[model samples]
Target: MSGLETEKELAEEFVLAAFEKDDRRTIRRMLTSDALVYTPNVPGPGLDVDEFESQILDAFHGAFPDLSIAVESLVSEGATVVCRFTMTGTHEGVFRGIEPSGETVLVTGVVELRLTGSGIADVWQTTDSLALLEQIAAYDHENVRGERGS
Candidate 1:
């Protein structure tokens, strides 16, 4: 395969494996020795290899009892993969300060990844968690108030 294909393939493999397995180990296996991960849900400036991988795996496991991602689009240039995808999961656990509402959410995002030697070198991702929260009724205070007639 071409260099671009190799990079793209690895990047795709990363997310697919993580989804299929629903485990952090899959994520770890996909990264390079020095990987950078950027996420909006996370506080502070992005994280390095160990911390980044750990945080998302924890977040996913916490946010969705069964979280998985589907690749919606992909573009590649040399060793970088730009991906757009949907993450679907059932909220069975607390997430983002909201209690479990037992709702299913599908959030979309754009992710840019760099590949190094066919492994993911770095990733920057931005996702629409607001839509997910809306779907899950995370901010249902108005509805609650209306029911109480307050």
Candidate 2:
């Protein structure tokens, strides 16, 4: 296989090994020193390798202990690889201050990875976050009422 194809294959392997298997070693090996991970859910500065592992990776692992990610498609061109995947998991642990809802959520997302040498240099990701929140009944909040008493 050509170099680009090899890189794409490596990236695919990295995603599966990291997310599905929750293998921290694989993740560390696959990310570059200056890697940047961008996610729509988290605004402001981009996530570095440590932040991605702790916030995104480990958080998901904690929330959805039995999470599974299925790759729908993987396309590569030059130094970039785009991955489309479907993630399904049960809400079993506290996530982002929300208690366990015991809800099973299925969300789809696409990740664009830029490879440097044999490691991923940067990642841009977007997912169906609204679906996840709805599945967990995140919007089922009590309405506030105002009282007038003088």
Candidate 3:
């Protein structure tokens, strides 16, 4: 395999390990200790490896105990790998202060990862938060109708 192919394979393995298997140990091993993580869900500065594990990984596991990520595609060039994925799960625990609705949600997202010899060094992630919220009935439709005098 060429260098780029190898990096793509590694990126695939990392995603499977992190989301499919939910193997925190392997995920940790695949990331640099000080890896930078950015996601639309989190505010302020980007997260480090530890914060990513806790805030992103742990929180997702809690909210969606049976969460699964299906990779739609993965493309790589140089040190950067971009993965487009669809995530499916049921809301069984609190997520972002929203109470559990026992609703199944399908969310699509893309993640760009920058890799180094030491492992993954940086990550930028974007997901369809509005879709997730709609799935879980987070919006107050009746209130909106009332405000509009409908």
Candidate 4:
């Protein structure tokens, strides 16, 4: 396959391994040593490869052990691949200082990956965090109302 095609395929595999399969080794292999990733929810400049693995990969995988990400579409130009995906998982473990809510959340997001000869050079991601936070807040409110009634 062509280089663009290869990059697209690698992006898919990276998503699968990191989000679905929780295969850290494969994820490490896919990212370059100096890879940078930016996410909408994160503060500061961005995350390096190690921070991405620890904060994003490890944290999400731990919080949502049954997490699944389905790639809805992918397109590529030059060394960049853009992927649109849907992520679904149950909030069974503490995440972002929130207790386990046991609520299932499904969110859609897009990720753009820049690949180099070594591996992934950079990534930019935008996820539907507003929708996710709304759901979680609703769940909490419902529980609070129920507790007050009882």
Candidate 5:
């Protein structure tokens, strides 16, 4: 296979290991020790591998115990692969400071992964947080309208 094809395959494996299998060890092995992750929901410059595994992966699993990711597509060029995926789960635990509503949520997201010979080096990810919140009834539309009128 070509290099791009190899990279795409790696990206697929990464996604399967991380989200489908929920294998933290495989994820850690796939990432460089100092891998940097960038996400809108996270504050600061970026997150290292450890932080990404804990704050994002672990916390998300805690919030949505039965969460599953369905990969819609993957595109690769050079050493970078972009994956589009859909996440579905029931909100059973607190997430982003919002209490659980036991509502099902479906959110779409994209993640770009930059790979090195050793492992994945950098990641940039974004998800539809507003849609997730809406699905969970976290936003009060009436209150927002009243505040707007005020």
Candidate 6:
């Protein structure tokens, strides 16, 4: 396999270990020490890979223990792999400040994983954050109605 293919495999293993296996340490060991997580929802310039794993990995995995991500498609070039995939899970724990609503959320996103000699160099990604918030019963529908003076 080429560098891109190997990187893609590593990325898949990381995701599987995260969502399917719920092994945070396995995924943690796979990330670069200087990795950055740029998510709109999280309040930070960026979260280090380890912090990202600690803060999110288990909460999401605990909430959606059966969470699974499928790589719907991919485009590989050299050491870069751009993956398009869907993430499906159920709300079995609190996400953000909201309590679990026992809702199932299936969100889609694209991630570009760049690989180095050691492992993944960096990952740039985004997903439907609003949709996910809504799915988790985080959005205040009553507030919207309240604003409308219902």
lDDT of each: 0.76, 0.83, 0.86, 0.83, 0.86, 0.74
Those runs of model 2 whose alpha carbons end farther than 4 Å from true positions after fitting are: 138-150
lDDT of 4 by residue, 1-150 (tens): 887678789989887887789887887788888889999778878898788878887777777889999999989998889999999999888777767788898988888989888998898977787666665555465676799999
Task: Give TM-scores for every candidate, taking all chains together and pairing residue i with residue i.
Answer: 0.80, 0.86, 0.88, 0.85, 0.89, 0.80
What clash count goes with each model? 0, 0, 0, 0, 0, 0
117, model 3: CA deviation in Å?
1.2
Off by over 4 Å in 4: 139-150
Report the C-alpha displacement of residue 12, candidate 3, in angstroms: 1.5
lDDT of 6 at 40: 60
- Model 2, CA-based lDDT: 0.83
Q: Write the per-residue lDDT of candidate 5 for residues 1-150, one digit (tens) a residue.
A: 888888888888888777667788888899998899899988988899788878888767888889888889999987889999998999999887888899988999988999999999998978898788888865877787899999
Backbone steric clashes in candidate 2, count? 0
Tens digits of per-residue lDDT for model 6 on 25-89?
78667777787766565677777877667666756776777687887877778877787879998
Q: Write the per-residue lDDT of candidate 2 for residues 52-137, one digit (tens) a residue.
A: 88888887889889989999988989889998999899999987777999999998988889987758988887778777777876
Q: How are the candidates ranked when ordered by TM-score, highest leading?
A: 5, 3, 2, 4, 1, 6
Residue-level lDDT for 129 in candidate 2 = 74
Error of 6 at 132 (Å): 1.4
Candidate 3 lDDT score at position 25: 89
Q: Candidate 1 residues 13-89, lDDT tens each?
A: 77666553555677777777778888888888778867765677666677786877888888998777998889888
Candidate 3, superposed: residue stretches over 4 Å from native: 140-150
TM-score of 6: 0.80
**Candidate 4 or 2, higher TM-score:** 2
Error at 53, model 2, angstroms: 1.1
> What is the TM-score (0 to 1) of candidate 3?
0.88
